[model samples]
Target chain A: MEEVVIQADKLTKKFGDFTAVDAITFQVRKGEIFGFLGANGAGKTTAMRMLCGLSVPTSGEAKVAGFDIYKETESIKKNIGYMSQKFSLYEDLTVVENIRFFGGIYGLTNEQIKNKTQQLIERLGLTSVQKQLVVDLPLGWKQKLSFSIAIIHQPKIVFLDEPTGGVDPLTRRQFWELIYEAAHNGITVFVTTHYMDEAEYCDRLSIMVDGRIKALDTPKNLKAEFEVESMDEVFYKLARQATRAE
Target chain B: MKAVIAENISKQYNGKPAVEKVSFEVDEGEIFGLIGPDGAGKTSIFRILTTLLLPDGGSAQVHHWDVVKDWRAIRNAVGYMPGKFSLYQDLTVEENLHFFATVFNTSIQENYHLIEEIYVQLEPFKNRRAGKLSGGMKQKLALCCALIHKPKVLFLDEPTTGVDPVSRREFWEMLKKLKQQNISIVVSTPYMDEASMCDRIASIQSGSILSIDTPQYLVKNYGNQLFKVKANDRYRLLEVLKSVPSTKSYAFGEYAHISVEKGHQMEASEIRQHLHQNGLTGVEIGDAEVTIEDCFINLLH
Candidate 1:
């Protein structure tokens, strides 16, 4: 049986009177790629922040990697990896240096960092440019490197926020392969993306509309439920139900 | 007649090619899209025609005037919404709109007809500061300000980036209306699906134009026999499919888009047999409809 790696029950967050994230409930299983879908300003970020322990929820509960979101944020932070829309690599550092720096931040031992760095560099075919500063790399290379570093510590779950924005189709394709590999290794991937095609790649998807879970199902089932041929249409059907900020 | 024209327009920054020798033309009342991934030189092309940046070589013309010599005239006749939000954040929406209108020696009342549709959506938030508006509202206000002077041409650079799907739909609808008003529109975007909404498109890469045609034309000649293939183990299926002879495979959404070699017939059985021979089963293969994105990736190869 697959363990529930992440669970949320009536989770809510309100900024002043505006409910940025209303009561929401969902669960992510181990080794699942769970897609958290929403339009910009749809409270997707607010909900993700609450789960990642970056922000406190005004009400309800969530458990990430067996850690309570409110009382065990420090433990939660240690067991889950995170990557945002913005590339978080240090531009001034070389590829190898950047990896070491991130590994160090995750409290990895020098020996573990060295072994993992070599394997990662070889797997990504970055040996030729591993000594080059990250800024000198192409946008695609930088993006791939960022994802690898995010999971350097092999966290049980990884939260990726728009990880493939502004990249070419080939590069985006390659990045998802990395994600599939991670999920194969029993890591839960919780991701949010504006790109609907990326949403289609997930194992299961939950769409938030005006801070509410409007739809939740597998991509195929969601399309069937909405009677659409594509995830884009499914998203369009659900997102338009918003009563605010249309 | 061409509303805008470019002949080998190029620009370099610090000895690196930002926009290599490139050329395209937009016809009057036609919507032209410059489609590519980031750093594909779409912005540089737009800036040159909008008179924001000068070309290092070749030339461009807007409103039948040279870009370099008639920069001021080009600026006056062309409306540009940059890739990023460029409005005054501290000011209210009404103030920003008025400021833009007055900059062109006009008023909102003078050209109210030009942007009435878009402005009405933003009217309720007139008193709210521009920074306080949502992503969709901010873009709408920007479009309103850009259209305040009734420019003959419009250049929108990635205006839908970061916008939600619903707002993106609404924004494109607004653009379609503008095109009907006989205003030539040139938009640059990384969203390949959006390229289909344009009347014609130029697929660009590495500072060069790969293919330029109406979206339908590009898809019709996608350069190979394409098939949509899927299996139970999709990730493994992708790797195994790559090993098949006479094929170029790419991940398109949940399925693998395989472009079989020319004259290969690319029957579903042949592909299924190939995967089955590799101990792979439960394979699904069907002839795929090519999109502008497929054409763009084909050009990349």
Candidate 2:
């Protein structure tokens, strides 16, 4: 049996009188590609924050990487990697410099950082542009590099927030290939994306609507349940039911 | 008559080409899309045609007015919602709309019909600050502000890039309604699926136009037999395609679409046999519909 890496029961967060995450309950196994999908203002960001130990849940219980949310938040942070489209690698740093910087931040030793920097640069095919500033690289290359750095410490899980937004179709698939490689190597991938086609790639995904988990299942199962031919149809059918203006 | 035209419009930044000899035309009252990924020069083309930036070479015209010589006229005739939400963030939604109307030497009531449908959605949040509104609401407010002047042509740069699927559908419906009122729209987006919503689309890449045609025409004329190949392991299936003697293969949703070589007599059974020998179980191969994304990737080659 696969090990459960993340378990949440009635996890809820509130801001004043408004509930951002309304008692979401789910379980994610190790080496699973778990998709956390929702619309804008659907509380995806807020829920992700709570799970990453950046924001405290207002109620309920949760454990990430076998660490309690409230008591072992620090340990949880160390056990997970995170990358968001809005924030990634430093723009002004060179390719090698950014990798070295992140490796050190993740508490890697001098030798580990050195070996990681070499392996990453070669793996990403950044050897030719290793000395170039990150800002000088193309958008696709920058995103791929940022993802590589996010898992530089080989965390058990990685959280990606719209990691492929605005990227070209071909390049986006290439990024997903990297994701598959990581999952195959026993890393859990929890990602949020607006792309409907990408939803089909996940082993199991949960769709959020108005701060609630409206549907949770594999893509094929969800489509069969919704009586739709494509994931896009399933998403439209679910998200259109949202009464919230956002 | 053409609503907008570009004759090899080019723009460069720091000796690097941002938009390279790009040329396209928008018919009056047509919804034309500049479909490409980020940094594909969509914004540069919009800026040039909207008279916000002068191209380094070639020329463009909006509503038959030269972009360079009649910059003021072009500005008055075009409504541009930049990729970034360029509004008075501190101002209330209502105030921003009124401000844009006054700047165009008109009143919101004069062009009320142009944005009535979209603004009605923003009515409840009219008093809310633009900065405090939600992402979808902010986009609506931006569209209302852009339409307050009743320009003949609208240039929306990546308006739906990060928008949700539902909101994206609504936004396109709004565009369809606006198009009916005789307003030409040139919208850019990174979503290949949205290509079908436009009357015509130009698949762009690295500052170059790959193809310009209606979505149907592009797909119908894709000129290759595409197959959706699926196996127990998706990534492994993708890797095995390298040995399948295909022209090109792309990962599309759940399946990897392989472009079967034209006139290649290899049957699907042979391909299945090869995969089964390669230890891929539960393999399925079927004819797949060609989408704009497939056309875009093929054009890239």
Per-candidate interface DockQ score: 0.62, 0.77
* Residues B54-100 of candidate 2: C-alpha lDDT, one tens digit per residue: 99999888999999999999888889999888999999999999999
Fnat, one value per model:
0.57, 0.79
lDDT of 1: 0.89
> Which residue pairs in candidate 2 collide?
none
Q: Indicate the worst ten consecutive residues by lDDT in candidate 2 chain B.
A: B259-268
Q: Could you give candidate 2's per-residue lDDT for residues A1-246 as a string of tens digits?
A: 889999999999999998989999999999999999998989999999899999999998999999999999999989999998675789899999999889888999999999988888888889999999988888889989999999988999999999998877888888998999999899999999999889999999999999999999999999999998999999999988898766
Question: Backbone clashes in each candidate structure, one number apiece?
Answer: 0, 0
lDDT of every model, 2 decimals? 0.89, 0.89
Q: How would you encode candidate 1's per-residue C-alpha lDDT over B1-301 as one tens digit per residue?
A: 6899999999998999978889888899999998887888888898889888889999999879899999989888889999889999999999999999999989999999988988887888899999988778999999999999999999999898877777888899989988889999999876787888999998788899877899888887776888998888877887888898888898888788998777776677888898998877678889888987787777776
Q: What is the interface RMSD of each candidate, in Å?
A: 2.0, 1.4
